[model samples]
Target: MRGKRTTTGAAVMIGALAVTGLTFAPTAAAVTPTTATINASCGLFGGGAATLTATQNGTSATITLSSTAIKTPLALAADSITSKLTMVKASGGTTVFSGKKNPAMAAQSPVTVGPLSGTVASGDSLEFYGGSLQMTIFGISVTCTASAKQSPGPFVFD
Candidate 1:
């Protein structure tokens, strides 16, 4: 009976050590991209509304702007539009990543931004600014421009 008790205690200690070792074992660091989709209303004069999808991997990011219709009082014929998207640091208001896209009417497309010189850390803000649309309506060409408000975000990067 004594011999059996000693053997059982030894086995229990070994099992405990194995579990402890596993708990402290080093794990391979994984680099996974974080993605966020943000939507904002630009009002009638600005462009109605817009949706932006941003993906961040390390220091690089890709931004996609879904085609949003512009609303104006004018009877428009054709439009040439471009929008610039930026990731700004919330603390300092520094733009970390910037990219532009000239989207077709009612189309969704991805615009790859950059291997950003500045890091887009946690707790950053994003803005869609410098938007211009050139429209040829009623045989006259007109250019309309507007800037979207800065969206508060933590455009996460893993």
Candidate 2:
């Protein structure tokens, strides 16, 4: 009986150690580029010297705009980053197209805001693609001023 109890205790301790090793061991965290898809069903606007707002999946986003003399002599307020989205007449400005995640957009063409079959202009897309994330945000804030030379400005999402 005493020998059996000793064997059982040893087995239980080994089992516990094995279980702890598997459960509590630190894992090697690897950063991989996850190709996740999102449904961009919100419309973004280039408010002439105003802030643009986008909302989807109960999340909201706001991007600041700053003009830089429009580069091609276009009448822009002048700000940091690429204010020249499109060379259009600035009549319609820019807008976001609603579409599903399609890899073809990244490979085939000049990566517009959304899908191709839509009214959104090629230049009229969110500023996120310019090395920032308009998505993956829950809240946003935008500020606009009339006397200010710079139109909209940098955006911060939480």
Best by TM-score: 1
Candidate 1 wrong stretches, greater than 4 Å: 1-46, 71-83, 96-119, 122-154
User: Which segments of candidate 2 are over 4 A away from where they belong?
Assistant: 30-158
User: What are the candidates' C-alpha RMSDs?
Assistant: 9.8, 17.4
lDDT tens readout by residue for model 1, 56-113: 5555555554433534443322233333344544455545333333333322222222
**lDDT, candidate 2, 67-150, per-residue tens:** 221111112121211221211113333433223222222111222222112132222323322222131111231221233221
State in Å the error of residue 147, model 2: 31
